[model samples]
Structure formats: C-alpha cells, structure tokens
Target: MFSKLFKSQSALRRFYSTATQNLTEKQEPKTYYKITLLRSAIALPKRYKDTLVTLGIHRRMQTVFHPHKPDIAGKILRVKELVQVENVPASAVRTKTEQRWERRPDPGFEVVGTWKNKRWLLDEEGI
Candidate 1:
C-alpha cells in the first residue's frame, strides 16, 4: 500500500513539473517592465515612497513602463508590496500621449461639417 501511494504521488509530481516547464518555455523573453502602483505609499517609510518616485509612479493605480534591467528590478523588489509588476515585450511600450489617446471614447461617425457648410462646399464645387 505504501509503495503504491508513493508511485502515484511521484507520477503526479512529474506531470506537474513538466506542465510548468512547458508553460515557461512557450513564452517569449520579456524585454520591458509594466509596473503599476497598487497600494499607496502614504504613511509608509520614506524609502518606500522614494522608491515609487524613482520608478516614476506618483499616484496609486498608475502604471509605468521601464526596460527590463537589473537595477529596475531591484527597485521594484524594494516596493513589491505596494505595486504590481508584469513582464511585457518592447512592442507593448507606449508613450503618455498614446496611452491617453487609447482612453478617449471613439466617435460613432466622422463629422465632415454641418449640413449648411457641407451644402455650401458641395454647391461651390460645381458638382
């Protein structure tokens, strides 16, 4: 009975290990850091707040991107509890303007002009 239990547990462990290996191997190497401040550093130690500033995070729930470098990783570790970090590819990087543009609501239709101006333009075109 003891031998049978050990064999089954060992088989299950092997399966899980291979499954984890496959998951890690299938992913591309991440080149960028996507860090978001989840919790506020308010009332925390000055060093924690300073680390957040060094990471360019000044507000809660704000996200910033940095290259995947050891220095940045160390800084992230310093405030890990107050922030969330994700690995991202270089192509996923965006500037502030691009990020803001993405948040804007899309207008349903294109507005060439009002009917009066559109009619005037149409009449003047001799069409």
Candidate 2:
C-alpha cells in the first residue's frame, strides 16, 4: 500500500513539473516609445520646473504629451534650448528604474545521496 501511494505521489509531482515547464517556455513582447527633453531646465529658474510640472514632466527624464498642435509645437520649440521632445507611447511609460531584476539564491540545497535521502540531512532518520 505504501509503495502504491508513493508511486501515485511521484506521478502527480511529475505532471505538475511538466506543466510548469511548458508555461515558462512562452515569451511575451514588450513595447517602447520615443521621448525628448525640449527645455534645459537644469540651469534655469525654479519656475522652469513649474512649467514642466504643468506639462506633467517634473523629473529629468519624465515624458508628457501635448496635442500635436502648432501652438504646442511652437512652445516646445521656444524651449528647445532647455529640453528635448520626442514621441512617447502609453505602453512604454513606467516608474523610473523599473527594469531592474533582483538576484536570489537557489531555493534548493545541494544533495548527495541515494534517491530517498538528502545529504543535507543531519542523520539517517531524515531529520
């Protein structure tokens, strides 16, 4: 009875592992956008930051939008010496420095023994 129970448990574990592996094999595409800073507010008055704030761009690399109108273009051009402007899409917007990945230690410890016992165990009782 114990042998049969163990065999069934192993089969279920194998099925779960296979399903997880299949899911991990799929890849997804990512979208990007173009942006530029038209004004160089870095050396300008604090009011410049206010202007950028009004435009929804408060940070150095922040990107915002204005309708593609001549007036908007003119304003951008007027401040061109201070900032850069570019085409940015909604899909590309994310929190600053959000692309970083964290490194983690392996979840399993190294084992060296028979199929039933793990080397990390303190004693033959399986700890």
Cα deviation in Å at residue 29, candidate 1?
4.3
> Best candidate, lDDT-wise?
1
* Cα lDDT for residue 42, candidate 1: 97
What is the Cα root-mean-square deviation between model 2 and the actual structure?
14.0
- What are the runs in model 2 whose C-alpha is more than 4 Å off? 1-35, 38-40, 87-127
TM-score of each: 0.67, 0.34
Candidate 2 residue-wise lDDT, 9-126, digit = tens: 9999999999887775433222222335644587777776566665556566555555556656655665666666655444445444442222344659765565565554546665
lDDT of each: 0.88, 0.58
Supply candidate 1's per-residue lDDT for 124.
73
lDDT of 1 by residue, 1-127 (tens): 9999999999999999999988875665679999999999999889999999998989988889999889999999999898899988777887768888988999888765687668657867877
TM-score of 1: 0.67
